[model samples]
Every structure is written in structure tokens, then in C-alpha cells.
Target: MIRINAIPLIASRTFLPRLPRTVRQYTSYNVAVAGLTESQEEFRNVVHDFAQKEIAPRAEEIDKTNHLPEDIFPKLGEMGLLGVTVPEKWGGLGLGYLEHTIAMEELSRASASIALSYGAHSNLMVNQLNRWGTDDQKSEYLPKLLSGEHIGSLAMSEPNAGSDVVSMRTKAELKGGKWILNGSKCWITNAPVSSTFLIYAKSDTSVAPSKGMTAFLVERGFKGFEVGEKLDKFGMRGSPTAELFFDNVEIPEENVLGQVGKGASVLMSGLDLERLVLSGGPLGIMQAALNLTLDYTHERKQFGKKIGTFQLIQGKLADVYTKLSASRSYVYAVARACDAGKVSRQDCAGAILYSSDRAVEVAMEAQQCLGGNGYINDYPAGRLLRDSRLYTVGAGTQEIRRMLIGRGFNELATAEDIRAYNDATINGGVRGLFYGIGLSLPTHYILNSRVTAYRNLPSPAKAFGFVMLIVPCMTITAEKSGEAFTRSQYEGVAKRELDKEAQIEHERWQSLSSVQKLGDWARRHKYGLVGASWVGSLGVAWALVNRNKHQTTSQKVVQARMWAQGLTVGLLMASALLTGFDSSKTEDPRTPHEDHTWRAILESDPHLNEEERKRLHEIKRAVVDRKEQLVKEASNSVSK
Candidate 1:
């Protein structure tokens, strides 16, 4: 008799309902990643303490007065934050983008305006100069900028060109030993306060906008260069943004930032870091919002109960918390990748885009949670909303950023490209580990090929691979498992966790409910599971037989057979209770319109005459009238 329960030990439902909304002190909430080095933790603590003690107190005054905190820069400089991304030889901290992002996040948590100005100075000007500036240029400007004696800003956006920065009107012409710059930059952060400005202008107007642009390092005192009126606006008030007028400004030949006609390269290269670093601003705002909401919910009462105790309030809190956690994870991961010099362009756009949008939503929700107080200026909720709104439009508009991300992914998504990426970057860590273990040559090659093949498979195939890999082991152990967990029960377990590590483990266990459900669904289809097992076993056996034909050495043949047997047994046991892939199933279209609207309706009934159209219109009208009537009734019922 066939061993029908070959993998009964593993088949159990993994997926389940989410935890219930509950209010409690998550005091052990440490948001830092578990693998943080000692130095990173120390640095984070230092920055957090600095933000809380030095920056937080001044945040209100800064917002109220709408004044740039010139005094704060010196303290930041003294702490070596100004040059965090710069090198030691260049009067910088010699740290990486990760550290820079940490500083940005901490500072922004206290005040986003301050953080915005800091980013414009540090990442936009100082870091770019460090990367592309000549030795003499660094020697002349690095020390003063790093020490906070000089402030710097970047100028690219112009009156008519914000998202289309390459089409800026600023024009620079090479003259005798200097360049004549004409035109003005609007909405320039740190413009009035900056001693140095890195401006982009068209060097060759005849060519394409991107190719014609050139970068120039213009000093504040340069002739014809003037700071214009400051723009008073909503939120980020203290950041001090203004127009920059360059009327025949004479820039020295040595001030040419990068190669003429290659300013686009300089500009595009710096944007990744700018986007990554600026993301911290939103992350900080989210954190502040979360803190404010938590405090407000716990203290404020309504309907004879603390609002925090209400499930609705708790649900809002949970959403904000989840968003903040996810944003933090993405931002930090991207920052680490930047530090590792392996940044993906799409991910850079994605991080800022995702975090920026979520930050605005979370801030608004925080404001809503506070009710009347959140609406008024007494709390920082209004300010947070205003500041967060700027992100959706700044750096790059959300629309443009979305296009960039989609375009980038489309360009890179190819079989060969995917395989190369896996070999060069994605699998580097694992490959190194295997190399360290001194695996046999054939084993190394085979494993790498397997991993590459797995990665290159289509999405559906990958899903199958995951199920085939996981479902068997779980199915075999299902007989030993206990009853399912309720949502409230899961939350209780999560809350009682003593530390971040324990909390993460509890979360992982809780998330298995959905997986368990999937496994159960698979178990319901017995024939499919058995067939998959046989197919997998036969495939493995056939592969081993073919390998034996090529193997001259007896040792190699033995090893191959052993590998085949192990894999076959593993597959058979796993697949005994796992579901098979159904080729007949069609993928759901990834579009918003389920029915394709009126076009689909018209296409389906193309033979209909004018009479049919008239009838359909009448039916639609009746439906609308019915909907309005129902809505009115619902409103009346609610009011009563």
C-alpha cells in the first residue's frame, strides 16, 4: 500500500487572522535592526539623545518664528554631522550613507525643517563635492563648510522647471578665464543663508537640455549673484527657501564643478543619495506622529473611557505603527545598500516615494486621532501635515518618481539581466558563504546554477517552488501541532515579549496563520499532491540517470546518486501533501478596472442598436436614483 500520509507531519495551516487591536505600553519597542553593530547602536543612541535634548525643545520656536536655526548648525557641525558622508581627509566623518541617514532621521524627528536644510547642505552640496570635486576645490571649501563656518546649498530647480530640471533657464557661457551665468533659481532651500551654491546652467543651448547643462560652484559674494525675496509658505517654515538671481555672474574657470556638458550625469548621480537621505525626513515625521498619537490616545478620554482603550483608536494606532515600521525597514535597507555601493535606482525612488506617501497618511491619521486639538495649532499635528505634504511634491513629484521607478524596472526586467544581477550582487553573500565552506567544484557550480535558475523562473513558478519547498516539511509535522490561535490571543503573546528579538519571533509565528490556511487548502486536494510527488521523484531519478552516463569516475557517480536520492526523498515527502500547479488557472489581470467600464459593456453588446442603448441608459439612471435614495436613507438613519 502507498504511504499516503508520507508528509502528514508537515501539513498544517500557517495563515490566520491578524491580532486584535489593543492599547498597551510597548515600552520595549526598539526599532533598530537586530544585526546592528555596536558602533551603529552607539551612533543611533547619540543622535537620538541629541535630537531629544538639543533639537526637540527648539522645534516649536523655530516653527513659530519661521526662522532658520543658524545656531543649530554649529552644534551639528561640532558633532561631525555636517560631514557625515564626507571623508576624513576632507574634514568629514568618513562615514557612509547609512550613518548619514541615521543623523537625518534623528534630526528630522525633532524638526523636519531643520532636517531639510541639513540635507540640502550636507548631501546636496558637501557630499557631491566630496565625490566629484577636484583636490584644490576640496582644500579651499571643505574645512569651512564642515566646521559650520560656511553654509552651502544646491540650485537646480528654476521658476519654469522643477521636475524638468534639465530644462532650467539658467545659462552659463565660457568667457575669458570665467563663465557668465544668467537666470535665477526659485524655491532654493538655504539660499539666503548659504555662503556657497552649486548651480546648474545650460552650457550648450543648441543641444538637448540634459546634454547642454553644466554645474558651477558659485560663491555668495560672486558679482551679479544675489539672493532674492524669501518665499513664505505652508510648513517647513524655518527652512528658509528663496529665489536665487544670477545676472551675468562671473564664475571662475576653476569653479566648473564637473565636465562641461555632463552636468546631467552629476545631477542624476547625486539624486539617488538625495532621495535616500531625504526619506529620513518623512521617517522622522512618522515617528513624531506615532509618539504624539500614542500619548494623546492614552491620556484623552471619551464616552467614559480612555480613547486608547477603544478598538477604533487602537486600530488607527496599529496602522500608524505598521506603516512606520515598514517605512523604517525599507529606508534603512536602502541606506545600507547605498553604503555598500550597490544601490538600485528603482529602489532609491521607491524608498522616498513609499515613505513620503505613507508619512503624509500617517500624519493625517495622527491628527484625526487627536480630534479637535489635532485640528488646531496647539498641537504639532497641523504642522506635521503641512510639512509632510511638501514631500509629495519635492525632490521629485510623486507622479514623476512613479514613472521613473516603473521605467527603470521595465528596462531591467529580463532573463539575462536577472541572471547577471543574481550572480553579481543578489547571490554574492550566499556564494561567499559556500566558498568559505570549501565545497567541491561541481557542488559549487551546481548550487550556483540551481540558485540562478530558481531566481530566473517566472513568478508563478517561483510560487510553486516556495510551496514545494515549504509545504512538505510542515505537512509531515501537522499531526503534532495544537489548535489555531485567535487574534486576541496572538496580540497577548506579542505584548508579553520582553525584547525586540522575542517580539520578532512572536510576529513571525503569528503570521503563519495564512500559510497554514494555504496548506489546509492544499491538503484538501489529495490526488494533485500525490501526482506532484511522483512527478518530482521521477524527474530527480531521470536527472541522476543522465548524470551517471557522463560520469567516468565511480566516486562522482556515487555522489550524484546520493544527491538524487536525498532530493527525491525530500520532494516525495513534501509533495505527498502539497498541491500541484494547475496549468488551467488563468492569472488575474493586474489592473484596477475589473470590468473595463463602459468600453467593456459596449464591446460585449456591439450588435445592440439605438433602442438597446436607450434602454441601457434608462437602467443606469434608475440604478443611480436607487443608490442616491439608499444613501439618503442611510444618512437619515445615522442622524436619528
Candidate 2:
């Protein structure tokens, strides 16, 4: 046998080891999970290592056999992952939704199917128990479920009630001392293996589902309860979804998860958290796709050069990176909101809506990058693509999400104010007249400049910005009329016009963040300040032009004085306009326009009647909601 000098051959000039250390280091890429706290990042790293060593090795086998990895549940329990959001006192890790999200992302990156089953157990069942279970109920089921001694799942969707969960046919009737559950839940994750199940059923058919439904904790050993045949799925096969049959299953009164006739609350609340956490699975799929593409692009060659070097390939990869980054950022921000107890229904929907769609696209692109290899089962890229497709149709379809988001924004619009911030006489009547005369001119000039910047904005945003610009001019005319002028009278006509324009533009201003809305309003109004200055400058120029034509020395002196005052106001407006260049600037040295926080806007008119006060309160609430939206968007940007 010839040794062939293997060591020397490996260390030859053409080998990578023979390359300069700096060259090697510079060529390597560094990728890290974004938007995570120190502890979260550490947890993610640990989970990544665990998934790579244990889950990835078994993923192929699990998929081939279509088996749920029952052994992994105990291991997850040992890692304090089974009860991620459960309180420590209840035999859990006492972590938040954000941490749970991190674990989900890392695990799903290796095996999406396994992660699907894990999500069904940890979030759908365990977290719901923690959120609504009575003390005795918690003590009875939580320990076993959290310790992996018992598997858990949730049953909500039925054959005809997937997106419209309220239309479910499942029912629980009170008979004697026990409640009897009838009807079946289909497409339930972990159904075949779950030892504990949180089931939703209608207790009162007379009332609407929003009020008549109730949640119950059902044990697998219950007399009439049975797991139906395991579902044969095209993707996420190892999760082992099945139909659950409840043939007069018996439940004690104490088994009710939340108040009777109020199961909708429990269901809705859990759905929000469910959306946030399940988002991590799609995020992980995107990440896995990106990772695989990166490696393949570096190694695969075409035309004697790496295929990744081509602009088209680079473009595809860049898009994948951007999508993954944005999705991760948005999901994490929503998870943080869930932890802080400041979550919004629309945001929960938005997070899943955005991430799920992007993940599918990113997975497809990843497979595309691999050419023929990605189409084959030998590579995991095909599997990632298959798994990612589930998000668009699962956990409420994209259509449902769109309608919910639109409805939420429309509600906010119904409550929003349609008038200028403040409209009142200043320095008695003289100053108000001067403001009316000069503000419109400078306002026009400033507004003209802003047109280009807002041109690309959504039609609603553009219309809003336009209406905002003209409000100050309208207010000036109203205030100039003094006590005889009611801002409401002028506002009536202006608002009608604004509403018409908004309608024509199809503007959904309510969708904008509070900061964004404020910015647009301010930018539009700043032109008034500019108009004031331009009016002065134009006046001075006119006076100077006709200076020699003055009939008397006094008139000449008066013209000179007019020119001087115009110079001052003109200079003031110019400096103000200069500062206005940055639309984000919320502070102004001369006026309170920049300082118009939602609180300040609310306080601008505190002496209103009851009806006005209520309207103002609604407006204030809209502002608060927008601010939260701004925070979430900002966090997403920073994370990216």
C-alpha cells in the first residue's frame, strides 16, 4: 500500500491552507442572527448547535419513515424548551415569547417538520395552559406536559372551519356533572402523539360564536376521545398531523380553560401568540435556504468561475438576504411586543402575513440558485421549499390576514381628526391678518419643493401630505376672521374636500405609523412658514422696484420700513425652511409645529364639549396606536 504523501499533497501551493491567512479570513463570511438580546443570542447559538448535532442527523430518516421523533421531546424538555413561556414556578423556563421564537428559529433551520411538532406542543398547548388554566388545572397537567412525560397539542380547526374557526361544529354539552364533547377536529398537529389536548367547542348554539364558545383541556385517555388516521401531507410530513374524534368525550367542569361562554377570548389571545411564534419556523426556513445557497454559490463553478460571481446570481442572493433580514426583524419585534404585553391584533397578523410570504419566495429562490441539484431530494433545498409553502395557507390564509389588517386600519381612520393642529387668533387681530396674508405665499413655495419627495409615497400618503400643506393656509384665513370665525365652519368645507381627495387617492393614512403621519403633516404645514417668508421677500422686492415712484418723502420712508420688516420675516421663514429640509425633525425654534406630539395635539383644545372630547379621545387613541406601530417598524429597521 502506497501512503502517497497525503499530508504534503494537501499542503501544496494550490491548496487553501497554503493561501495567506489574511486572504482566507477576508474571503470568509460572518453571519449572525439579528435583533436578539445577549441572552437570546446565546440561547440561539446553543439551540443551533443542538439542532445541527441531533435534529439534522435524524431529519432525513424521520422524513423517510414519516415518523414523529418521540425521543426528541424528552430532550427538548431537558433543555427547558418544552415550557419556554411557562413561569418558572410552574416547572418551566420562565422565558418570554422572544426567547421561544429564538429556539423555534434555530430548530426549524435544521428540520422544519420537527419544529412544527415542537411548536404545536410548546406554544399551542403549553403556553395556552399557562395563560388561562386555573391553579388546580395547572398543577394537574403542566408538570407532566412541561417535563415531556406527556405530549400536548391544541384542536381548533375542523374540516370546514380553518380560517373561520368560529364556524366549528364541535360542541360540549353539560349533562349531569360532566360535559360531553362531540364532533371532530381535523388537521391537528401532533394529534397522534399528544397526551394532552386543548379543545375549543361551542357550549351554546343560540348565541354567536364570539360569546358562546368555550375551551376545555382534554386528556388523551378520555373514554370517547380517539386519534384518527395520521394525515399524509406533501410537506412537514414528520409532524404527524391527524384528525381528532370526540365521540361523547367526558370532561369535568374544572377542565374548562377559560370562563364558559368566553372561549373566543382564549382562542384569539392564543392565536396572536401562536402567529408570533410560528413565524419563527418560516424565518428558519429562509435562513436555511440562504445558508445553503451561500455555500453552494461559493463552491459551484460555471464557465471556469463561481456562479455566485454573476450579477444575476448576486441579485438573487441579495434579495434572499433582504427578505430574510426583514422577516426576522419584523417577527422579533412582534415577539418583543408580546412579551411586554403591548401587542396589537393587526401587528400579530402583519408579522405572520409578511414573514410567511417572504419565506416562501426566499425558499424558491434558494432552490433556483442550485439549478438541477436543488430539484432533487438528495439536497435539503427542495425540502425547505416544500416546508415554506405551508405558511401561506396555514394559520389563517393570506387573504384572511389582508382583510383583518385592512379592517383594523379602517377603524383607526374612522376615529382620526381631520383638522389642522391649532386654529386661533395670535397677538389679537393685526398679527392674525398678517399671518393670513403672508403664510400662504411662503407655504406654496415650500410645498412645491416637497412634491418631489412625496411623489413616490402611497396615494393616500400623498393626498394626506397635500391636504396637510393646505390646512395651515385655511387656518390662517379662519383665524384672520377673528371671533366671528368658527374653525369648524371652515373645517367642514376643508374636511369634505380632504375626504373627497383622500377617497379619490385611495389613501389609507391609518396604516401609517404615528411618526410617519406626524412627519407628513409637518412637512405639508412647513410650507406655510415658507410662504410667510416668501410673501415678505416678494413685498420688499415690489416696494424696492417702485421706490422712485413714491409721490412723497413719507411714502418713500414707509416703503423703506416695509422693506425692512419684510426682510426680517423673510429671513425668519428662510431659516425655518432650511431646518425643514429634514422632515424627521420634530422640534422647531420658532413654532410648535415640530413639537406636536399626540399628547400636545390632545391638549391643544381641552375646553371642548362631551362629544368633542370623545372624538378627541378617539383621535388620541389612534395616535397612540400609530406610535406603537412606529416603534415596531423602527425596531424592524434597526434589526435589519
Candidate 3:
């Protein structure tokens, strides 16, 4: 027997003991999980050891029997793994989300079904209670649930309302000092064996769907409350899922989980954390698949050599390993963010979305690596594949995650733009005030010359000039004065016209199908659009210039071609700008400081923080002082 250190050498940054070449060739070592403290590493090892010993052996049996081992819950409770995020005063380990995520990942590596059940109980039920439950409700339910003496579950989904939770028909009516729940919830995890449930119901239908919902604490023994038959799921067989039926189930006022009409807030508060922790399930499954594939590739032989020796097999191994490492790193990074109290909806959704999709691909690759042996139940690859598919549909569907991420980015960009606009307005006002004072004579001369020219024009030209120039100047003056005078009356009318045009454009864009949009893009850029357009215009001009019999000199023709080519290029550039083709998208528009006057650069960087802006101002002052000193030296040299 050989002994090897299980701690990851990379994580500890320590030297490893040298071993014989033969020993090193046959040994398989563990890669250190990153982003963990010493205590977190120890906790992970403890959970990993327990899971392999107690859960891995029974994983096959549990899958086949479609039932979890009877003592698994108690054993997990005894190890204090049941209430990972609960406070110590509430009979839990009182750890943060990172630790909880580690526990989920290790357990999932052993048995995904068991890990799913654990997450549902620990995160969905226990953590919610810890966060939102009243003191009395906590005293009554937290201890039993935390100890794993009684099972817990959360009910939010209905038969018709899985992704659209706000459409749930579960109504709760306040009647005679009690709330009566009168609807059903389906596809609930741990429903068959759970003793307590955190349920949401529509309390006030008059209000909006989000505002009308209320969360309640209901027990299994409540009158007219019953758990239906367990669902025969495609995967996660051992985690019992069933429908819950309620017919006039009475709940006391004290059992309300949060405020009467704030269930959405309570539900939303836990969703990001839930998504973060549950992401570990997919990470574990990916690890497990990689593990099975590595062992089989090493042992299995083909064509007088090990299959792992083949280039194709080695490539597959590399791909899977890279994916697993990348996914693990991303998940851990997001978990750390969550633990640091920087929970972002988009980040959480994005973490699970990316990991879950990759897990499926990794599982399929693992099965492919095993070749014929992968398809059979004898190998765990088939089970891993089935389990890996559940995540993209379970917490929230992949589609919902994408939409959430898009909306989050849209909101962030809009807020940033608004802030930039406000900053630009303040800076522009100050600069305009100083310019008006310093350049008053030049500004007045320019305006007076334009006015006199307009007055000298014909009646029709004068009317057109007034509409284009005079009205715009007047509007600008009125807008700068906060639109406080007579021009303010027409401001609303002009705004309405602008809004109408914008709405028409928006609707036109929305009406185009995705295929149409793609086709339009292709047409717009076909045949190197700008290049071809400019070249074609120049060719036409050249043809016309050569065909002219009146041109007696080659110099005039040469000048004509040059003017035509320059005009064509300028028009192409202008068209590109108007069509939103930004040629400098990769470059920061605010950069190349030497191109702008110092004041211009300082005015443009409104996105910089106050400290950064102050530093920039100091640099500008230093540059000005240095230039002034250089000028003085030059003057003294000339005088001498």
C-alpha cells in the first residue's frame, strides 16, 4: 500500500516529497480546489470523506431502489451538514454560503440525487426560515428541522405555474382568525416526507400579482392538507418529489413567514443564494464524470495498447479536464462573491447558467470517452448524464437565466448613461458660463454677422434660414434657462413629436423577425459595403471625366478625379456614422490625451470617480506649470 498527501500542493504552495519513477507513474493525485481558506479546506475534506464512505457505496442501490437510505438524514445532521447556513444559536454550523456550496458539491460528487434533496432542505427551507421567520415560528420549527429529526420543504411551483410563479392559483383567505389555503402545489421536492413546508399563496387579489402573494408556515398534519403520490422523475429518483393538495387548510396568523404581503421580497431575497449553492451540484457531477472517464481510459485496453494512449482519447481527456477546471473556478468565484455580501442577480444566474450547460456537455463527452461501456448502467456515466440534465430546468430554466442576465445588463447600462448625462450637464454648464464671459465679443460678432446675412436673403430663403438657425438658437437659450418662459409652452409639444417618432422607430425594429434582422445585416455589409460603394462612385466619376470632350488639359481632369474620390470617401464615412457603424469601437473614445487640450480631456472623463478626477486635475496643473517654466526659460535665454 502507498500513502499520498490529499491536500492540494498548488493550493498550499508547498514542495511535494519525491517518489520513485515507477511509483509516480501509477499514482493518481487530487488537484487542490481553489478559493478556500484553511478551515474551509478542512471542512471540505471532512464532507468528502464522509460522502465517499457513507454515500458512494449506496449510490447505485439508492438509484435502483428509488429511495434514499433511511439513516442518511440523521447521519448528515449528526455531522452538522444539515443546516450549513443557519446560525449556531439555531443548532446549525453558522457557516456562510461558500461552505454550504462546498458541502453541496462534495455530496453531489457522490450522489446527485441526495445532493439535490440536501440543497432543497438546507437552502430552500432552512435558510428561508432563518432569514424571514418570526421568533416564535423559528422557536417552533428551526430546531427540529435543523437536527434532521423532521424533514422540510418549500412549495412555490404549481402544475401550470413552474417558471411563471406569480401566476400561481394558490389562494389564502383570512377567515375567523386563521388563514385558509385553498389550492395545490406540484413538483415539490421532499413533499412526501417533509414535516414542515414554507408555502406561498395569493392573499390579496386586488393588488398586483407580486404584491398580493404571502408566505406561510404550514405543517403536514394540518387539516385538509395532504401530500399526493411521489413523481417518477427522469432523474434525481431518490429525492422524493410530489404534489401537495390543500382544501381549506387552516393556518394561524402566527405562522406567517414574513409580512402579510411581502412574500415576493422574501422569495427573491433567497433566490440568488439558492442558485449559487445549487450550482455546486452541476460542478460535482462534472467532476464525477471526469473521474469515471479518467479511470476507465487508464485501465481499458484496445489494439495492443491502452486506449488512453491514443491521440483522440487523450484529446477528449484534455477537453473534459479543461472544462471541469474552468467551471469549478467560475462557480467558486461567484460563491466567494456571495459570501462577501456582494450577491448579484446576473452573476448568480450567469454562474449556474454557464456551469449547468457545460456540465451536460462534459457528461456526454465522458460517456463518449468510455465508448461501449458508457451506455450501460454498469458504468455511472448514464446516471451522470441524466442527473446533469436536471439543473438547466430545475432552479430556473436556461431561458429565464438568459433573460434575467440581459435585463440586468440593460438596467446597469441605462443607470450608467443617466449618471454620465447628469455629470456632462454640470460640467458643460460651468464651461459654457466661462466661455460666455471670456469670448463674449467674438460670440456676439458671429451671431450679429449671421443675423445680418439672414436679413439680406430673399423672402423664401430668409424663412428657411429662420426655421433652421434662428429657431434652434432660441430653443437652446430657452432650454438653458430651464425652459421657464414663453418657449416652455411649446417644449411639451416638441417633446411629444420627438417621442412619437421614437416610438415609431422602436415598433419598426421590433416588428422585424430574427431572420429578417440577420438578412438585413447581411445585405448592409455585402461585398464590403463601404469599400464597394466608394470605389463604384469613383469609377463613375472617372468615366464621366474621361468622356468629357470639353476638357483640354490633363491637369483639370486629374483635379476632377481627386475631388470626386475625396467626396466619395467623405460621403461613405458620413453614411457609416449615420448607420451606427462605429469604426473605433475597440478604442476608448476618451483616450489619446495629447490629441485634446488639457481642459477637453478633463471634461470628457465624467465616468471617473472623484479621487481619480482629482488626480487628473493635479496632473493637468503640473503640466501647465512645467510648460510655463519652460516658456520663461526660453524668454530669458533670448533676452540675454
Candidate 4:
């Protein structure tokens, strides 16, 4: 005698309910076609269970005590997660990027602060050594990290050099045969508890700091290696952060990580992986936020009825879903590139940028829906909100991402810039320009102007740069479209994708529009201002470079080489700006409400699907059958 058709039934048919499957699909599995292997899945289950049972129960207590993840380093090491990419010969799992990213994303979902501590220990610090360290260094250090015998910490940030990396002041002087390092590293995670450190210092005081920088492997037991006072932080309390003081630490030439003048190279090369891990860790955090918010909205009732039934709440829920899904898709695109052996600095930067930015957005929405209760620290959302704040500012600020993006404008049409606006910067005709507008500008008007300018023709080298400029268009495609890349768009058996996109667009816009448009006039005020600036910068750069008239065939070939280099620089910068933004704010404000509401239950508890669920049930039955039989063996063994 029960009927569930209870709410706004008549009006339901007027609105599309199911989300567009393309966005839905991309949102869920952003990594690419490869799902987890059975073993990988088992690893996921064990880790998930461990997190839920151990970490979740104590998360509040641990967070309150500012319990750093140092004590937990041994546990993650035991789980074979740290050496995800190192060769097993060096005591590592040698797993690919997908698996590593998955582990980061999943564990972080429970408590991002803990995940950060553990991830930095196992991933950023250890993996960097594995990738670039000499055989002696690996033999000496990798095993310690893998066995959890030694905790590795990175000492990159200083009192200065947070974003401007080249302006470091730590000095390392060469003393006859041994190098004496004398400086202090600040804001170092795992510093107080760390047994090993990857320290970057300037070897030659006179040369450019970034260029003369050298990397050294320092151990806690070293004579001059001492831990200073621990630095208290707002989030990531699950990891011990401290100032590391080094006073005339004598390190032999043997301890050098790479070549003397190659510290910058080592740090830069390792940074790509660091960014990848950092980006991957937040995927799980967002997923958890979604699940928690879903539970609260559904369970909490108002006015003698489930509040979730109200259109206003449902609209909020829908918006949360769409934003999370879009961010996931963006993360997955970057993951795909990284997993496919495309772990360039640009690729990782893009991944970090997109994931971090999305994380802030999703986390904020979760906080908002919790209403007054969302502000309370007792709830995970409160902690997540505080924890997520550091993403944009810690590694690189959003402003830095934007500025870096500015460098790539010569290539990526997706970025907006000031120069693109006619008299925008000078005459104050417009403030900013965006790329989507430039690309979508009326073709006749835009191209006619370009064609008129094209009359000058320029030189072969400059003309080739034009081709490089068009290459980013090659990246445009549906988030989940399965197609070979074209120079400017997608091409393949994409009939299904094309059809799904229309339905997807309608739903996506609907969900996004529900959040109340701030002001349409403000949005329409400038179109593609950033992109226009990018185009203008490229134009100016082309003008400044002297045109070479050398018509030799070899010289023509050299220009081709130049084009490739130019493409790489622009693409990497574009990817960084477009893909690598971590947060929308330098510091995001969050307040947890004192009370909250919830729906009965949630999704992304990461339960098995129907078939898998059935299989799990069957396995449980089989385990029960074996339990009684196993008691006899236990008794016999005990008797023996």
C-alpha cells in the first residue's frame, strides 16, 4: 500500500532528470579506459577498509590533537604504496601513475591532511629520490623509505622562495673536498619526524641561485642536521611540519643527488610527479564531500517532511553533482595524459591546477548545503574545508598559474589575456579578454582582420609558428569522447558521443544555472579578453624577432626544429595555466555550522555494483562455510 510518487509528481515530467551520460561518465572514471586489476582492486579495498575503520574513527581526535601522519608512515610503507613507480629491484611496486594516483585519491577522501602527510612522505620525497638518485643513493636510501625504517621529507620551501623559486637564500659552500651546508628550511612537512631529507642549496654563492642550486640527501643522524620547533598549521595537522636547521653540515661530494649545477633540474623533474600526486590526492577528498553532503540532505527532515524532497535542496544537490563530475573529468584528462607516459611538467601542472580548483569549488558547495551545521568542526566538511584551503597557496598560487598561462598564450587559444582586447589595457577599453570568445568570435570579422594582417606573410619561420599556434585546438574534444585527436578537434566513430552531447549540454547548463546568476551583465561585459591578450602577445613576439632571409634547405630544417621547441614551451605553459590551477583563492574562508541535516545514506561509499555485490555475498557465504572447518585446524595446531 506504499506509493513513492509523492513529490511534485505533476511538475517532474517538465524537467529532465537524468544527468547527461557523457559528463556523468567522464566525471566517474577520469583516469582513462583502464580500470583496476583484481589485485589493485584488492589493494583499494584493504586501504579503504583500513581508512574507514582506523582513520575515520579517530579522524576528529587526531585532527584535534594535531596528530601528524608521522606515526602512520610505517603503515603506508607496509602497504606497498610508496614505491608505486620505482623498480621492484629497488624495493618498490613499480606500479604505473594510474595506480599511484588512485591510492592518493582514495586515501585522501577519508582525511586529506593525513593523506598529504603520507603522500608527501611516500610519494613526493621518496619517489623523487628513486627517479633521479644514483644507484648508491637508491641502495642506501630507497630501502629505508620502502621499509618505513626512514621517513623522507622534502626541504624546498624557505622563509622565502614560496613561488619565486629562483630567489632562494640557503647557501652551500664547497670546502676543499666536502661541501658545508648552512641554512634553515621552513614549512617542511614531515620535518620533525623525518629521518631523511632532500635538501636543495646553492653550491656557488656567486652564480645565479636557481642555476647554482644542488640537491643533497641529508639524514637526521647527520652531525649538523637538527629539528627546530614544530610549526602549527590550520590544516594537514595529521602531518608534522617543522623548521629544519642545518649549521655547517658537512656532506661529501658523494652525497650530491645529480650533477653539481643540476639541482634545479632534479627539483624540476621531480616536481612533475609531486604535482601529479598532489592532484590525485584531492579526487578522493571531493568524492567524500559529495557522499557526506548527499547523506545529510537526504536524512535531515524539516516541517515534518524530508528536506531533500524540496526543489531548492534538490537543485543544490544537482549543482554539487555537476561540479564534482566536471572536475573529475578535468582530473581524468590530466591523469590519462600522465598515465600514458606523458608526465611532463606541463601535464602535471594542469592536473594539479584543475583538481585543486575543482576541490575548492566542490568543498565550498558541500559546506554551503550543510547550512549552519556545515560550519561546525565536528563534521568532516568543516575539516575538509579548512584542509583544502592550502592547495592553491601551498605549491603555487592561482595568480602564479594565471601568470604562467600568460606565457603560453602564443599557442593555447583557451586562455584569455589583456592584449587581445582592443585598447583594453592602455585606453581602458576593456579590462580582460577571454579565449573561448576569440575562438568563437564571428568567423568573418575575426578572420578578415587576420587575413588582412596575413598579407604581410612574414617569413617561413614565423609562418611555421602559426602552425604551432593551431596545435592546441587539437586537444578539443568531449570529456569522455573516445576518438583519435585531430589538429583542431576530434575525429572518429563519434556518433554516439555527438548525440549524447546535446542532452548533456542542456542538463549541464541547467544544473549550473540553478545556483542564481550573479549578474548576466558582468559576465557579458567581456568575452575572451584573456585569449585576446594571448593572441596580441604572440603577435608582438613575432614582430620583435628578426626575420631571417637565409633560404638554405638546412636553414629551413632548423626552423622546423625551432617550431617544435616553441610548440613544447607554449604547450607546457598552456597546460599549466589551463590544467594546473589548484584553487580559486589564496586563502578560502570556511565556517562549520553547529547543527546539520542528512539524507538516509550516500553514494561513493565505494560499494560493489550489482554483480560484484552478489559475488561478495557469495564469497561471504563461502567464508562462513570455511570458518567452522578452520576452527578444527586451529585447535589441532594449538594442540600440537
Q: What residue runs in model 3 are displaced by over 4 Å at the alpha carbon? A: 1-33, 412-640
Cα lDDT tens digits for candidate 4, 386-408: 77777777666767765555554
The TM-score measured for candidate 2 stands at 0.62
lDDT of 2 by residue, 1-640 (tens): 1112221222112322333233214322233446564467678778887887789778767876889876898888888899988889999989899999888888898899999999989999999999999999999999889878798989999999988999999999999989999999998989999899999999999998788999999999999999999988888988989999999999999999989999999999988888889999998898888877776676567787878899999999999988988888889888887775567788888988999999989989988987776776766777888888877888889899888888986652332232222223433344544654465556555656776764455767655655665566555655565443445545776898778756743454566566555544544454374466546655665567565762455444444444544564445434434433332433422232423332233222313444764553454455345545655654554455
- Winning candidate number (lDDT): 3
Clashing pairs in 3: none
Predictions in order: lDDT:
0.74, 0.75, 0.76, 0.64
Worst 10 residues of 2 by lDDT: 3-12
Higher-ranked by lDDT: 3 or 4: 3
lDDT of 1 by residue, 86-180 (tens): 98878788988888888888888889999999999999999999988999999999898888889999999988999888878889998887899
List, residue by residue over 1-640, the lDDT tens digit for candidate 3. 1112231222102212222122223322233557575568789889988998899778877887889676888889999998898889888898988899989999998999999999999999999999998778888998888778888999999988988999999999999999999999998999998999999999999999999999999999999999999888888888899999999999999999889999999888888888999999998898888777766666566776767899999998888878877887888899877765568899899889988998999999999987766776766888889999999999889999999899985652465655654555555555555554445445545655877764465777544543454444444543564424325435655888689767865786688777545544533453375457556765777776766676544543454445455565465445434444445542322345322333233332323555765565455455446545655654554455
TM-score of 1: 0.61
Compute the lDDT of residue 125 as modeled in candidate 1.
95
- For all candidates, the clash counts are 25, 7, 0, 41
Sorted on TM-score, best first, the list reads 3, 2, 1, 4
**How many backbone overlaps does candidate 4 show?**
41
